[model samples]
Target: MSSPEQTTAIVDAATDPARSPRSLREAWLALAGLSAVFLFEMLDNSILNVALPTIGRELHASTTALQWVTGAYAVVFGGLMLAFGAVADRFGRRRTMLIGLALLGVASLATAFVSTAEQLIAVRAATGVAAAMTTPGSMALAFRLFGADGLRVRAITLISTVGLVGLAIGPTAGGLVLAVAPWQVLLLVNVPVAVLAMIGIRFGIAADAADELHRDPVDVAGAVLGTAAIVLALVAPTLFVDAGTGSWVPWAVTAAAVPAAVLFVLRERSARHPLLDLRLVARPLVSSGLAFKAATGLATAGLGYLVTLQLQLDWGWSPALAAVGMLPQVVVLIAGGSLVSPFVERVGLERAAAISAAAVVGGLAVYSLLGRFGYVWVALALVLVAAGMRVVGVAAGTNVLRGLPKERTTIGAALVDTASEVTSGIGIAVTGTVLAALFTGDLAASHWTARQTAEFQQAATVAGLTLTVVAALLVGWGIIRGRSAPITADDSDSSAGRDDSPGAEADAPRAAQHAG
Candidate 1:
């Protein structure tokens, strides 16, 4: 059997598409498409964090309501990725992406005009649905544009890096906007970026409709169940009280969610073509990569906001000052991403990813300990942590896409993004709940005295440590379990060619169909 690289070469040799342009032109087009979409999505993700206080004051949004603004986006975005990915496959990448971008622009424009908190929340959910379509479609389209093996890995790395850079610099970027412009400007900003990407996608990238789009009935049942499961999970913290409250409401909601999820899984397995492909996720490579994405993205995304709050609330740093302090880490993230790409092909995906994960675990552990000193130590810790994420993020994303059949690329990318979004959403909610619990418990016990303040501080330290340990464990598990199977489309196709016998013609079509 040929190796992944060799098989990729063979596949490339067999049905060489006419070279319409140089590889550089193709790569640049993909880069432009990816970076534009990523900037829009990630900018929306982080912009709210920087502007939340202002938004709250102007819009009369309570803490709970503000949480919904972020959570609503995450829940809807994560819930519908599978549906959107399948739609993209059924239709065409260019067509689906353009539609999604237009909807996102409309949603963003609507957000600017929202008067009530409910209206803003509703628009954000709409934006989330649009985001669900954009992120995964963009990635899968990149894979299709650049072929899946060597070219795909490099392109995925660059795209992931660019997105991370946007996230890393988002605080400063959001601050700059807020300082000069109104809070509504953040939502409106997405309008121009989405338009540019839509135009580029229309002209620059070629479209490929999935040759074998799922003809199975749309899995409406599965989508409903899955959406319920995610929503219940996301809102459980809010619906029920903290650990001290001893509320059974949380437990019951959680227990019900598990069974609903089980039903969703069973339905998916039995259906001809489920909205979300549970079968694809059964592969070790895909699952492990997604696991890495979820755990790492959760900790990293939530912690950025945590650090920003610490800088502003605890250390009395201005928003702009905090953003500046974070600039070095953002630079390190970009550098880290570029440095790891050469090693990914050289050392193999699993080993390279494991080393990167080890770095992440170490870096985050340092943050769990050193984060309390002040902005300086916190900045250093973040740089190291972001550096580690840069390497692992690329590996996790590329390896998952690399191992799948060509047909599953879009759905798989959607699943990966969904995993990250869901985890990040859950983590933020959990962390917020913990902080709130500590604050209330301390204050109530002492009537808001000095001792209560000390207790709150102590609780924060403990919570930070516990979260760090959990993050480290998840990252380590992903590394230890991250093994890519030898079942790519190129490998399967090559194997089929080697088996030319009496029934070869009869089986060739079946083999090709399955490979797809």
Candidate 2:
């Protein structure tokens, strides 16, 4: 009963000598390279955040212009990831990744010569383009490097841990570097990272085989429509945050996204060779994985934004103190990687995903209900959410790639990331809008009266609860959908001679069981 794709994946894993790495030690070089790519993605924006004010002063840039310096990167990166994922699958993952690393190095070096905010924005966008090209490939390449499910989970956990460490330290590291070097050094550091990534990947991983590469022509029309829909969706959240609910721009953008998405789905359904095969996505494992990832992203982003605001604005903590206060979450994130493999082994992948995702919901609920009482509640909330995020991040992504065919792994990775990115934006928007609606007066004011303080806490609670509700729904659906037969070598053996056609009606149910 196994689907053709699932059957092929098992056979390939069982038979392929090329993907021989069974443990992290066996593939350190290639993994190190992929980890570097992930580090850049997580660190770039975070490191730049600390230097934004300095850049504004040095360049005499307006507030709006300064925002674009960061925004441009996010917009371009989120917009192009899916398209580039498809491209890498067709052409070559290694080839595309090396080219992207080169572009990243060049773009990072350009920071030294950026004399204006506009120039900086352009450079950031270029890096974003580079990120789109390479980020998804990192996960895909890592997955492809290993044949066993356990090794895949461990490899992804290792890479994600490195990235999480970078994210945790970025702002503090940026601050330290700024004291001794120009702001440009923050970006210029990427040059070395990119160089190391190139060496590791080029020397460590093998080139793609002819059979692994896609043979069909790229779906240009689907690409265009998909990109447009994602771009508009990303832009709408920012508009809601910046322009407020009254602004017509965000509403207009949101409206435009619906039609673009519809058109893209329609085009894909009708296309000879779609950019993203909707049929694959319809598989329970893929859908469940995406939903779990989306839930984590939403809760993580929302909780972080809300907590930062409460720490600095409501409690009157210094920026340094607020950063230190967030250390619990950071510590748990970096340390929790060690727990993922054991937990998954003990409980199984689907159960681990469900439990961890529920933990995220639980953390949000804890904060919503008890965060107003004391700092202890806030720290607990952060720890719970961080722990859950760490596990689910690895588990959900592994589920997705495992559910996919080997040839389509890069796009599968891209879909996982896109789900996270889009939902993170929505998370921020939902919390921000709720805060805006319930709390009156200047949020950035230096001092707040007792009434303002009370209103802020109320707003935070309402916002947190709202986010928790939304996250719960996502997690609930994921758990329900994820409940299928676990994909295993045993199933593959029994179903090897059965109908392995893509058009088989029973394929989805059979494939769903295999994702675990």
Best by TM-score: 2
Candidate 1 residues lying further than 4 Å off, grouped into runs, are: 1-22, 57-63, 168-182, 210-212, 237-255, 305-325, 369-377, 429-465, 484-516
- lDDT for predicted candidate 1 compared with the true structure: 0.68
Angstrom error at residue 473, model 1: 4.3
lDDT of 2 at 142: 87
TM-score of each: 0.79, 0.91
Q: Which residue pairs come into collision in candidate 1?
A: none
Clashing pairs in 2: 485-513, 486-513, 487-513, 487-514
True-vs-predicted CA distance for residue 357, candidate 2, Å: 1.1
State the displacement of the C-alpha of residue 93, model 2, in Å, after optimal TM-score superposition.
Answer: 1.0
lDDT of 1 by residue, 1-516 (tens): 436654344334323433222242334544676678988777787877888888899899998788888878877887788777777766766678988999999999997679988899999999988888898987876666644244555666677776777776777688888888898888888899888788667655666534524455667888788777876766564554333336677768778878988998998888876877776676666777877777776667557656765666555577668768777777787776656646765665656666666565565556657677655667776876677677776677766765566656777788777777667656665666566666644332313456555555555566556666777677666755554454455435422112224444234323332332
Off by over 4 Å in 2: 1-19, 484-516
TM value for model 1: 0.79
Writing each residue's lDDT as its tens digit, candidate 2 over 1-516 gives: 546654444344334536455446546677779999999999999999999999999999999898899999999999999999999989999999999999999999999999999999999999999999999999998887765566677888999999999998999899999999999999999999999999878866778877667877899999999999999988888898888988999989999999999999999999999999998887667889999999898888889898998899999899989988998999999999988887877676777888899999899899989998999999999999989999998888887876777778889999999999999988898888888888788888978899989988898888888888989998999888876555445323322122234433223223322432
